[model samples]
Target: MTSSTQAVELQSFLSQITDRDKGLTAACAAIAEIGAAAAEMAELIALGRLYGSIGAATDHKNTDGDVQKQLDLIADEKFIAALRRAPVAVVVSEELNEPLVLNEGAPIVVAIDPLDGSSNIDANVSIGTIFSILPVLPGAGEPTAHFLQPGRVQLAAGFAVYGPQTSLVLAIAGKTQIFTFDRRVGAFIRTSADVQIKEDATEYAINASNYRHWDPSVKIFIDDCVKGADGPFGRNYNMRWIASLVAEAYRILLRGGLFLYPGDHREGYADGRLRLCYEANPMALVAENAGGAATDGHRRILDILPASIHVRSPLIFGSVWLVDLVSRFYADPHFSPERAPLFAQRGLMRG
Candidate 1:
C-alpha cells in the first residue's frame, strides 16, 4: 500500500523466510568458520601462483584426465577441519569416497564440493566451493531437515564463488540472497540482485559434441540456443561451456544465463558429471529461490531423491521460463521427448 508500509512488509517477508527456519543461526556461524578456512585455500592458490607448483603428476584423478592439484586436497582437509567444529553430525565430500562422521553428537549433516572448478586454478580461472545443509534423520527437528538429509531433502543450500572477489549465494527454502566478501572486514556483505532469477534469458551453455547422445528435450533446446537470434525464440542466445561448475553457475547468477551439463555417452558419465548433494542441490536451492530453476533436464533438482550423499546427476539450471519450457518439452508429445536417443528420434518424435 504505502511506501513505508511496503518497506516494513518487505522486511517482514524477508525476515520470516530467512529467520523462521531453525538451523539458520547455526548455519550463519558455520559459514563464518567456512569463510575463515577458505582463506587457507586462497593462500594456497596464491602460493601456487608464485612457485607454479601444483599437485604432482601422481595425484591424478580416479575419474578422468582432469588435473587434481595438491591444493585441492589441502582445501578439502582445511574445510573439513573447520566444519568439524560446527554442530554437524556427518559430512560428505566429493574429495573423499565416503561420508565422514565428524561429530557423533551433532544434529545437521553436510555435503560439500570443497573446491569446485579446481581445474581452473592452474589456468588462473575462477573457482569456488559448494555446500548443501539439511536435516540428518529421525531425532532431527523441524529446521533440522538439513544436515544428514539427502539432496532431495535439502532444507538449505548455497555456494561460495572465488573469483576476482569472493562471493556467496545462498538459498534458505523460499528466498535466495547473494553476499560479497569484504577484504577489510573479512566478512561477507549482502550485495547484488536480491537473489531473484530472471524469468527468461538470452543465453545458454552446453557441451555440443554430445549432441547425438542427448535425449530429445536436450537436443531441442541446444538447437534453439545455437539457432540464436532465429527460430521461435526470437532473441539471440550466446553459448558457453567452461566445464567448471562454479564458474558456469557464477556467470548465470551475476547476469542471467542457462547452463546444462546433462547426461551423455561419455564414459563414467552415465548419470552426469556433477554430484547431486554438493553441486545440484545448492544450485537448485539458489536458482529456485532466486526465482529461477534447476533440474536434471527432467524433474526439479530439489525433488530428485538421492540414494547416497555422493550421488551424481545431470544438471540443467537457470531462468525459470527456460526451465518451465524444458519441463513442457519433456511432458509434450511433440517436443522430441523420450527416454533415450533411439525412442526420442525414431519413435517418440516421428509425427
Candidate 2:
C-alpha cells in the first residue's frame, strides 16, 4: 500500500523505472504529454457553466457522426497540440476524419478519444480522455497502419477521469496503476501501484433500455441477472449505467463488476458504439493488466486486429469470472439459464 507521504509523482516514477527499452520509453513520454493535457481539461471542466456552454452541441459532427460538443473540440485540440510536442509519430483521434502525422520518424503512435462521454458535460457527470500507445510498425507506409495492429502490441494504454478528484488509470510494464492529480503539486501522484479486480462481484453495468434490441445471448445473460436471488445465478445483483465509459471503468477497477456494450439490432449500432482502437483497446489493456479480462463476446479483445482506426466494437470487460461467463453465453447457446435445464437446476453462480 502506498502512503500519502510515500506517494511518488508520475514523472519521478517514470524516471525511476530501469527498463530503458526504446518503445516503452517513448510510450511513457507520450503518457506524460497526455497527463499534462488531462490536467488542463480537468481544470476547464471544473469551471462547469462558468466555462460557457461547454455542453452545448455544435454544428459540427465527429468522425463517427455523433454531434460534437463544445468541450469535445477543445479537448481534441488540446491533446493534438500536446502530442505534437511528444515523440508520437502518428495520432488518430475520434474528432478527426483521418490520422494526423506528427513526426514521421518517431517510434510510437497514439490513438485517443480526446473527450469521452461529452454528452454528460451539462449533467455534471464524469468525463474522460482515453489513449492507446503503440510502437510504429517497422515497414508501415501509412500513418493509419500504425494503428491497425492488435491491442496486444500496445506499449501502454490508459484513461484520465475528470471527476471530483481527477484520476488516471494506466496499464504499463505488466501492471495496472492508479494516479490522482494533485493540484497543490500540479502533478499526478501514484495512489495504487498495482490494482487488481476482484474475481467476484455482484454489480453489472449496461444500458437496460436497449434490452429489446439486444441479441438473444445478451438478453439471456441479462435476464438471469435481472432475476436476482430467485434466478438461476441465485444471487442479488446491482445494475449501473452512468453513460460514461471512464466513470464505469474507474468504478470497476476500484471494486469489481462487468460492463457490456454489445452489438444490437439497431441501425448504426450493430457493431456497438465504442471505438476499438482508442476506447476499447485501452480499457481492455487496463482491465487485463489488473488481472481482469475483456472480450468482444466470443473473442479476446487484445487478439482482434482493427480494420480501421475508427471502427466500432462490442466491448465486455471486468472480473475474470464474469467476463468469461459472458463468453460462455456467446459460445454455447444452451449454456443460458432458460436453455440449459442442468445449469438452471444446478445454479451456475460461483464464488
Best prediction by TM-score: 2
Clashing pairs in 2: none
Task: Give candidate 2's error at residue 38 in angstroms.
Answer: 0.6
lDDT of 2 at 97: 93
What is the Cα-based lDDT of residue 43 in candidate 2?
A: 93
Off by over 4 Å in 1: 1-22, 55-67, 139-152, 336-351
Cα lDDT over the full model 1 = 0.68
lDDT of 2: 0.90
Best by lDDT: 2
TM-scores of all candidate predictions against the true structure: 0.82, 0.94
User: Per-residue alpha-carbon lDDT of model 1 for 81-109, expressed as tens digits?
Assistant: 99988877777777776677777766567
Stretch of 10 with least lDDT, candidate 2: 342-351
Q: What is the C-alpha lDDT profile of model 2 across 1-351, one tens digit per residue? A: 212334888997777652555447888888889999999999999999998999999999999899999999999999999999999999999999999999989989999999999989999999999999999999998888989999999999999999999999889988888999999989999988778897668899999999999998899889888988888787889999999999999999987999999999999999899999999999999999999999999889999999998999999999988898888888864585545454445454532
The positional error of residue 327 in candidate 2, measured at the CA in angstroms, is: 0.8
lDDT of 1 at 152: 57
